[model samples]
Target: MGYFKDILKYEKKYRRFTVLNIVFNILYAFFNVLSVLAFIPVLNILFGAEKRVIDKPEYNNISDLGNYLEGSFNYFISQKIISEGEIKALSLICIISLSLFFFKNFFRYLASYVITFLRTGIVKDLRDNLYHKIVELPISYFSEKRKGDIIARMTSDVQEVEVSILTSIETLVREPLTVIISIGIMLFMSVKLTLFVFILLPVSGFIISSISKKLKAKSIKAQKETGTFLSFIEETLTGLRIIKGFNAENVIEKKFNNSTLSFKQLMTSVFHRQTLASPMSEFLGSATIITILWFGGTEVLNNTSTLEAGKFMGYIVLFYTVLNPIKLITTTFYNIQKGEASAERIMSVLNTKNEIKDLPNANAKEGFNDKIEFKNISFKYKKEYVLKDFSLTINKGETVALVGQSGSGKSTLANLITRFYDVNKGEVLIDGQNIKSITKKSLRGLMGIVSQDSILFNDTVENNIKLGSQNASHDAIKEASEIANAAEFIEDLPEKYLTNIGDSGNTLSGGQKQRLSIARAVLKNPPIMILDEATSALDTESEQLVQVALEKMMQNRTSLVIAHRLSTIQKANLIVVMKKGEIVEQGKHEELLAKKGEYFKLVTMQSLS
Candidate 1:
């Protein structure tokens, strides 16, 4: 129920629809009681229990109103029966009951109809907000989170909420009102029997509640297992080639099967407990009815009750009517318990504060100027610093190359400049202004990053090239593609630029994908370009072509080049050699080579390889 309080905010958002649902549900409950009570007059007509009255009943206070109405109705029916016969009287009663039943169902339909908007609207908004949060959160936030777990939150957990909570909105409103109205009618018909019924109900509620107490814990376990298996699925699809190559499919399959089996076992227990609500409530309700039947029958037989034979029969039916609603409410409570588990998971994400949000007075940087400088910055993904007290300055329009082994912090410089992760100490600056003070959108806007993986979407070549620069004309895309050496192969495809590259551009060769990535950066034409080993994964000929395009794109731009192959940085304005997160040496290509230091050793190693 506390989790329900968190979800009430969404209800407020769709308040108009929620209010309509409540209003119509109240009508439905009122008619639900009337439809059952309509049977009392029918029973009176059938049993010939009418009492004669010469005049109409007078207006009176509500205390004796029930008896007065009963007497008045019997008197009217007696006159009708005396004139019209039993068949006509029975026919009139049947028609009134039928109308009451019809209106009851009609209002029920209206309540359901109005609530559909609120239910689906909340689900839609949940998805929208989830996606926005996923996209807006910093890259570092995802490093420790499983991709499948996040996907599970968006898919399975949301579906659970829809089934358990959102769908219960109608039952939450309608069923209790139905129970309340039914009890009111029963009390008017006979208060002592209703009071006996009230005594038995709390005991039944306690039993149902006891059964549902452990449901939330089980549901949470089930949801987590679902995420675990889904992670296995995502991982299998992503690394299918490697798995098959290593003949490790059986190992992965076993892990996934075990995960699903655990999920299946947990859900079996959860659903069994959930299903108990119906029969358990039904049994308890039937027991209460039997108790009422004994007591009310004794009172009637002894003439100690105000309820007559006909009204007592109607009272029994109305009390039985109350059972179904009470049963429904019990089931709804169990469902909400299950929903509470999912609600907690969903809110954990929605309520998460982004650690990398812009400051209150953050300024939007227009474009790059002066220089990009790392002022004694220290950053760490976890405990150990990846870059420590590292400092460098790349002036505008200068191409600076950082050369190092895999873990020597070459690529980390690009990450820091782009603010993918912030420094634990010191500052990153552009034109003497701290990057933390600049709006992230504008700070990244001045840069173009092309990494070694050649990340591309499942889109056409022209569209992929136009990704960051969506409004660019076709001519601009073509000109950029030609500069990146991608236009030649793109035009050779059957559909030319319109050809759909399959997922992540898998249909293209490695070199072609790399060229498309380069074309994308070329199209953006940002002043600051970060080429993170753009040609590192290619063969001799492909690397030659991609390297040529990289040089073309880097022309007249302030560029940070992270290179493993020393040949690529031979002509850089400044080449910095790094060792264990510290700059070992930095100078022009010939100057560093002449010193026979770390840079010279790197050149010698690459030349031999």
Candidate 2:
């Protein structure tokens, strides 16, 4: 119920709907009881249960309460004197009974109608909140999570929470009220019989509850399995080309099938456990009914009760109504049990602590000044360090290149400088202030990055380049493209800047996309730039074009370049060579070449014919 309470809190926004629903439901319950009593007066008129008194009728005990009610109704009939010959009292009682039935149904419909807004409203609000949480969560959280699993929670899991749980609002209120009203009437019929119900209810509740004890734990596993399989499907679709290339379709399919088989088993278990609720509760209610019949029949036979045969039959029927509600109440418990899994999954995301929120009193840096300093910084994704005791300083308007092997933590350095991830052990200062003390927005705004992959979008070329600088003019965009050497091919395209690049710029060649990425950075023209082997993936002619664009971009900025090819950093004012995580060499490109150390070894390997 703690999970259910979390879901309920969303209804606070629609509290007016809640109040209105309550009002109509109360009216419905009152009329339902009144409707059942209406039948009593009609029965009294027909069966002559109404006492024809020597003097005016007077009140009796509550069981005699129904008797007094019938007598008073009879007096009203006799006083009216509007006799239509076919038993005026019976016709009058019939009219009231029919009217009570009409209003009983009317109020019931109104209650349901009012709750429609509340249920859908809560569903909408819950989904919106979850979406916001997903967007706000840091990218690191997604590293170990499946994309498909997240999608499933957003779509299928949320929908299940809505249909299975939100739709229970009617049952959540009306069923309990129905039982309360029915039990009240039954008590007035005989408190002695009602006491038997009290005993019967608890035992049945205990039995039904025991069946659902482990239901929540199983349900949580089922939902997790759903996420796992969805992740598998998502991974399969994403890498379908590679899978087909390697002829590993059967391998993936078998794994997918295994995941699906497990999901099926879990769901079957959940259903069977849930299905036990109604039957077990129903059987228990039936036993209670049989017990009442035995005890009540004996009283009537011994002349110790005044309940007539028809009224007794009607009371038994009303008690049968209580059976369904008891069953439904038990079913809701199981449903809540199942919903616990969804609630836990959804809450996990919603309740995640944001690791990258701005500090209070954080001030925005006005612009880049002094030097960008990496002072004895270190970091790790897990336990051991990936970049240990790494340090470098790019003086304002200088070009610095980082040359290293594949896993030598070049990319990790880029991530740290960009503050995509924070360093663990030391400070990354900019213009003599700690990067952590500055607002992230202002710090990131001062820099531009062009990664190895040359990330693009399935949008117009203009939109992609003008991303951060949304209001950049066409002329400015054209100049940036020209400077990046992308203008020639861009203009050759049918729509030029307006042309769609397709997904991740897949429509264009590698070098063309890289040039456009450089163009985007040029347009931003931030004081600082980081190029992660940007031109390495290009063909010979395209590589030359992009290398020229890079020289132009780094002309007067504090630039940090990571190069795999060694030759690209020949003109760098300072060349820093790294092995693993530590910088093994540093100085002017000529000075590093003269060292004949790791830097020279890399150059010799790459410079050969």
Candidate 3:
């Protein structure tokens, strides 16, 4: 009814394993009863009380039942003592009994072994789907969610699903089965005594259910707090340098203290509810057994019941055997309730609709032909539309530079071109086809993107640069590196192409990383490229080096360049000056400067004395 089924939807892939596990578990339960019955025979012989038969046992009704047993015992001992083999027959029965006991355990182990595959397979698929969903979601999703919370769902929350739910599946199937089988055996022995057991079950079930109700609430809070603290931890790692730089260690520490305190409160509640399961079940079980002995003993001692002394003790032991499974089942219910929270969290990610999925019947965008058009396109992150009635066009193989101050929709234009957030109104088209109508992979395949952040994985220099084109040969990678002017410094490194860049390529300088980004774009050799303030964060020399490399990559491709530095794009084919999401000026650098308009003012403001 909830995320349990949603999370277990992954288990459908292991249907064969599930069927086999159920079969083995059924066999295990059957033998669990037989193993207990094996003791009945041993006790029968020891107490000189094995059921016997008198005369020829008839094939009739309950009136003939005593005669059947009386006849059975007479024939057995008469043949045994005559041949002096009664003890040998007894030993043979014991051996068979032991074998049944061993087979039961063997099948039980098989059930556990088969279910291992299903549990681990579900976990692996859940994690894989979570990661896939994370990437496909709009960037705005990450903007609102904490990084630590996402990481917690992937790690700790998933582990909870494994430990609390996946691990309990066997108990879900096996424990109830053991309870049912034990109750059946107890009934066959004496239904009056068995019905007494039935009355106790509903009471035990009620108390366990009550404890489990509180578990889900506390477990949900615990998981939420785990996410909150994990977010704080992730933030601290990324901003450690900033925290120290500003001497704000105490402020950050206080924030962390608050998160952990909240987490501790929630977990305390969860564990408290979990602790109730064992003792409550144990008490109920003891009470049920004591009641059985008091009532059953009266009938046995008064000769009102046929149950013998050893047989009566064995039935009590058999009922006791169910006590542990019943207690375990109680604990399992609490665990499932706790794990239900994690399954909901995991399913939330898995169920999240990707905002950037491909259009139905979408096809790969071939190489660019006609000019790219941004025709009356409008968009926003949320609420207010930032780009209203916006339109522009970039010719083939021309660099169109977008320039403006912050919050003026300069970067929005860059993002829209990459389809990071699809336009809320109108359309962006390549050639004549709407960008939305083409698969994102195919559409993006034609363009090389270099963002202001220079996103790079923690990997080798060669791998980072080759990310845009993984099939590029080493010589081609070197050629691309040389073109971006990154080859000289790369050669000086200890491992050259094989050096690890650490997280986000932090081992490389801003300029060096930017050059590497350009090198990556160069290797891709796309028909169009988007460069968002590529050299804006660099010092003078670093800016010049990165700029020259970027210019080299831009030589033959259609480019959309967003620049804060006016000097870098003075030679751009056309400069589009924007203000508050509207184009105020669009023409060559000289023409916009000659007009003494918005573009001219921006340049005048940034000019050297």
Best by TM-score: 1
lDDT of candidate 2 over 1-609, digit per residue (tens): 787788888888998888888788778877877776667544654565654333458985765876687577666654433344337766777787888889889988988898999888887887888889887776678887888888878877787677667777777787788889888888877777678778878987888888899888888888888888998988887799999999999999999999889989999999999998888888888998998888777877786866766667667777887788778878887888788788878878888898876789889998987898889998998888888988888899988899888888888888887777888989899998988888888988999999889899999999999988899999999999999999999999989999999988889999999999999999999999999988788788888989999998888898999998776788888888888899988998889878799888888888784
Candidate 1 lDDT over residue span 1-609, tens digit each:
777777767877889998999899999999888877766775655675644555777758978887788677767776777788878977887788889889899999989998999999999988898899999988887887888889999999999999999998899899999988888878887888888888888998998898888999999999888889989999999899999999999999999999999999999999999999999999999998998899999999999999887778888898899899889988999999999898888888888889887999999999876998999988887888888899999899999999988899888888888888888998999999999999999999999999999899998888899999999999999999999999999999989999999999999999999999999999999999999998889999999999899989989999999998778888899998898888999999999989999888888888888
Question: TM-score: which is higher, 2 or 3?
Answer: 3
TM-score, each model?
Answer: 0.97, 0.90, 0.93
Task: Report lDDT (CA) for all predictions.
Answer: 0.89, 0.83, 0.85
Please report, as a residue range, the 10-residue window in candidate 1 with the lowest summed lDDT.
Answer: 45-54
Clashing pairs in 2: 62-65
Per-residue accuracy of model 3 over 404-500 as CA lDDT, tens digit each: 9888898898788778888988889889889888988888899898878888899999999999788899999999999999999999888999999
The per-residue C-alpha lDDT of model 1 at residue 260 equals 94
* CA shift of 363, model 3, Å: 2.2
* Model 3 misplaced stretches (Cα beyond 4 Å): 49-97, 301-310
Task: Please count the clashing residue pairs in each candidate, in the order shown.
Answer: 0, 1, 10
Runs off by more than 4 Å, candidate 1 = 50-54, 62-64
**Order of candidate numbers by TM-score, starting with the best:** 1, 3, 2
lDDT of 2: 0.83
